[model samples]
Target: MDTNDKHYRNPEAVLDLYERPPLATWPLLSLQHLFSMFGATVLVPLLVGLDPSIALFSSGIGTILHILITKGRIPAYMSSSFSFIVPSVALMKTAGYAGVAQGTIAVGLVYLVVATIVGIAGSGWIDRALPPIVVGPIVIVIGLSVASSAADNAMMNGKHYDLTYFGVAIFTLLVTVLFNMYLKGFWSNIAILLGIVCGYVLSVALGIVDFSKVISTPWLKLPAFEFPYISYTPKKIYWDAILSFAPIAFVTMAEHLGHIMVLDELTHRNFFKNPGLHRTLAGDGTASIFAGLVGGPPITSYGENIGVMAVNKIFSVYVIIGAAVFAALFGFVGKLSALIQTIPGPVIGGISFILFGVIASSGLRILVDNKVDFNRKRNLMIASVILVIGIGNAYLQIGSFQFTGIGVATVMGILLNLILPREALSEE
Candidate 1:
């Protein structure tokens, strides 16, 4: 496969078609990819007390806008990440959703800070401090800390308060695992979606779902649109946005490196050398900025989709572009949002159980891949401190600013990795 094949040759020569993907090849790839991420794309809005429909539309629009800004050179989709869920939900409660939205807009500005730093200092500075030691544990905490929440929701029932939902959630989890472990072709690619469908059908049979909300939602409704309003007032939360969203780039950047590694393996090409780290960081940062600008969550290069691409052997960037186009169009449609809403909480909650677990597992995998030493006293000390501080929500207070949970753990890991004796390095 030549790296540069043009899609939709135009007389005017618009749409640079990075790597020159064909015009006609986008729909199925795009639609399938869109559906794959639908359950997740609108989740941020729903969690943060924003209109889910608006979130869907914005996510799609933000994605396309990011691609356009980058000239469609990167094969990635932006969606809602759960890392912001706690802070967003908290912001919505303490301040109004509008306040949280304002904070999110400021969060986008944080991306510009990252982009600027990367543009000037480059990714090397970041790469040194945040190697697998620091990043791996933080990623693990990202998933494990939420493990209880997903399971609790999955098992909750308003009816009798029995463990029935737990059963359903477990069944779905098993199906997803079995599919990924044994299934091949398209079936393997959509293990999560298939698991959700099976869980949904079962829940409906059990009388767990209520479609009343879907019925009440208007078919031709317009999504609420609000642009980010810049403000200088203290109540506007310009500082809180920086505190909540800035640290997230550390997590996202690590994931980006893993995605690049995945791409390199899939295409048998050196994505690092060709597009180079510079181009990829530029693309990821651009996507994140658009995400924050439109009151959506930050966009990270998702490992799940990258796994799908690897499994299906789909190397064309057009597929991702197709996915972005479909997402943007679907965002504008009210019924689509309504239908997504109809997805029972148990169903999504059930999947979240597995998804969150996998995230933590991925972090562990990073450590294992790096051969981190667990037996050494120094290594164990650092790792133990990270797990305890992160999972325990230990924080170090400095005046008004507080660092806790993943942030505290991340900083500690970096310090240990740098200042600790060589014997402290894990030999796993």
Candidate 2:
């Protein structure tokens, strides 16, 4: 057999075979990716006390906007980011539900500003000022710091049980790690799905999952129309959420750069050089802007789905477009979101363990790609400051505004990067 026959040489062909599949194949692939990301999409709404259907609907529409902004060149799926989940929880606790609503609306506007910044300065300028020194460690911090809570929850089975959920979580995590590392072909791509299946089985056997909610949920119903702006109280715009999340758009913009790079590698085309980073950045911004407007959470291009496209070698943007259409349709169906919510926690967590890790690793890859010299004093300083401030919840107060978490870290990194001069002794 020819080498090309044994392994698909064309990215489009591989995508056709495995990743860039048409509408007919979307149900399975979309469902699989959906499960991996569903917890994140729902968690924000549940915690912030917003309607989950709106989140789902916005996510669907956001993906469409992203595709349109990029002129349907990039094949990536936009979804919820877990980074916002705990923040949403904190916003609710500190400022009440109304405060969270106002804060989220304000946060959406931040995305618009970031999009505008990219539009004005152009994409090349973004790389010069921010670079990997600022972006890499911050992403590592984003993953590890945000993960502490999940790890803690996994260890404690509420107040009553001990070590049971911990064991299950560990088992789930191990399966994800092993499968992603060792498994190949379709198995690798579906590792999260399989791991979730195993975790669900165990949860059922242990009687940990309550199926009553699933049973009681209606099979079909119109999505509850959530007027997110309805809850927007001007007095309740918590400065903490506004300051803390707004600057995060910077790091998120860096994250978009990584996604574009991966797509370029998968497609064997420097997408940035053509339809370009500027176009993709505009796409991301538009997605975020439109998503926010529709009472949806902020949308980011999913690296996991890009990996799916890379592995499958399906390069047709239409496939992703079709996926977007499906997501949009499903968003209007309350039963769809409800059905996903019915999945056992451990199962969802099992999938999250894999996907989230992949997200963090993608950030590290950015640092590596830039060949950041960690040994240098300037580079080390930038990396250290960003990671600490980002993960340690470093905060600053100026008059009525409060800056903390990723927001604080992003601003700090950008300043340090610009101020710190390159070494006199330059080496190639």
Candidate 3:
């Protein structure tokens, strides 16, 4: 039969795969993709003391929603965003978990607004508004802002720098690095998971792990789901929290565009032109809203899954669909959720140390890759001010509302980029 005739008989066969691999390969491929994103997805919820199961479930639903929204064209997985970690933690302290959810929903709304604008106009304005000068520092702040939290966790909630916990953290970090750098194929992809397992074992031997919760937990139970609006009333709403966290969406929006660009290079397809920025942004925004409603972390495109696709040469959207199914299914197992919660604080801390550092480094790479002129007075002024504001946790209050650290820095960077004269931006 001709290629066209064969494709007609099996519509899925002709989609993106070079050749339709066997059904047996699908699960394994899906699992690989899941493994790649597993560490980061679980870490976000763990950091904020949320249910990892809910995050996993929300991510699966969000990924599926994104696929449906984009007509299954773009190959991306939606998962908890680290960008929300610092703000979510801060907001949770003042506004409570419900407040965090409300703020997150506000951020998702921002995405919808931006998506609407992109739908009407093109993505050019997004680039103009958030040049590398603006985005690079914001990304750095997103990571650096939380650096102390990692250290605090490593010290067992700031008790002190005990050698035992520090030792465990270092071991986990080394294991993850070794697996990622030296391993090949499947082993390499699961480096982070393997590192966690090794760290968990060490923690157990050191008598740090608490298994009582795991034993008491049921094997099968529904996820602990919470609704944002229903859980909190207007009187309890922290408008300041909403204002502070919502603008982070602008950072993630730029990140979404970067992810699409990476996918385009990996798949050799112009996803931006095909799925179009509007569809992708809208899909992401909708997914984030869903996640927020369920009291899960905000969703963003998974770079880990993108890395999986790049390594395996598998670009099939169905693989991501299968992974999403697995994630959602795992969310229903109460024992699995309990087990995740049982993970020692130090183990999370160690992994986070690496993860947060990687985030900061990625920001640096963005500036380097884009050839951003740091020597220029304009760039230096913008970057330096952002770093100070974010790292110093400089908080600005207007009435009852407040902008903290990253929020204030992000606004400053954007405004500076816009207000600075071009001629004054000359190279040093």
Candidate 4:
């Protein structure tokens, strides 16, 4: 297949690679993407009882570092991973904040070790271990895994289904699809943004959009940055924290590969061979190290931003960079950051409906483009198990850390691929 031929199945990027949107619409376009990634990044820190500002700061810095490490060749964003929440919370109680810092650092160290091995041994084994049959369903799971969250936000308000909120979500989704399908020229490229604007307006009219929290927030403040040395006892080792957190790294690495593979299918460039897996892993590891030092959650390449890339069909590294800069700036402006959080859940859900669907479709496209024949039971079995396990959310809890469905599914699929004996073609 020609380069990026699979992209034809979806919309071809209007502003691909380094290209930028018009000067007038640049910030708006970037803001649209920032909205895409902001919810989960901030939510992870909040869930783990850490200050969200530090997360925004670290994610921005880490993302820029990732871009630099990859030589600006990949359009990806780094954000807080949900994987570490359980262990992070548990360790915080036993080991305290300082110990959690050490645990987070341990997680980063794991990434570095894996990256070093990849650098020395090369990334060829990645393809051998994870072929398309195994990868496609993982990609599908990545998009559909959080589907229930989207549905909950769409119709439910505080655990109860609210018809008003349901209407808002549906309306937002409708507007987004209409704009995407009907708009001409540059306007069509930002259909998600336009939809969100319309949805937010409707929410405000219905009195669901809250501004009280934004009003109380300060105009400027420094993020509460933490250092391990400030709290760690001299010459002390935190093995409990390390053991709880380090093993989870393998699962996230699996996710890292899945996300990169999704991009490879979306951009039609073999990232595994180009910038190579080692550089991405090295960049990811370094970012996580920075995050842990500053008392922020570990960073992972974000799938939400990938969803936005697929929906907008604008895979520009500049756009990703712009969003990162904006995220970092918001980390300092308490008022602005608080205000962004006020964007109602329905609006987020509305946009996510389209974004996530686009991601799942891209996964399907990979199967189609690669001609994955389901006629073969082995091919069929691997894809089926991955899909069911991932979408069903059948997770494995390792100590405090719960290995997510997609992560578990990825690992299981690879093992199945490697372990299962294959029959010759004549047998079929």
> Which numbered prediction scores highest in TM-score against the true structure?
4
Error of 4 at 210 (Å): 1.9
Q: Name the runs in model 4 displaced over 4 angstroms.
A: 1-11, 230-235, 421-427
* Best lDDT among the predictions, by candidate number: 4
| TM-score, one value per model | 0.73, 0.74, 0.71, 0.94
Q: Please identify which of the two predictions, 2 or 3, would achieve the higher TM-score against the true structure.
A: 2
Q: List lDDT for all candidates, in order.
A: 0.62, 0.62, 0.74, 0.85
Q: Against the correct fold, how does model 4 do in TM-score?
A: 0.94
Candidate with the larger lDDT of 1 and 2: 2
Superposition error at 22 for model 4 (Å): 3.5
lDDT of 1 by residue, 80-184 (tens): 665567677776677655555554555455555655665666555545665666666766776676566666667776544457787888887788778767987
Tens-digit lDDT track of model 3 for 68-147:
88878777999998877877887778767776787778888888887788788876655666777777777677667778
The sequence of per-residue lDDT tens digits that candidate 2 reaches over residues 1-428 is 33213233443454532235544555565555556556667776776666677777777777778777766666778876544555666766777554444445555566666556656766675466557687676666555555655555466555544567777777777886687679886566556666767776787788877766657766665555535456344464467876666655555665566566555544555555456666676676666656555555666776556544443345556666665666677676656656667665555544555554654665677788778887788898888888888778776655534454666787788888887778635532
- Model 3 / residue 319 / CA error / Å: 6.3
lDDT accuracy of residue 387 in candidate 3 = 90
Q: State the lDDT at 298 in candidate 3.
A: 88
Off by over 4 Å in 3: 1-55, 71-110, 157-160, 224-276, 292-323, 399-404, 425-428
After superposition, which runs of candidate 2 have C-alpha atoms over 4 Å from their true positions?
Answer: 1-19, 22-25, 79-110, 159-161, 181-184, 227-285, 288-326, 332-335, 363-371, 395-404, 424-428
Each prediction's RMSD to truth: 6.7, 5.9, 6.6, 2.8
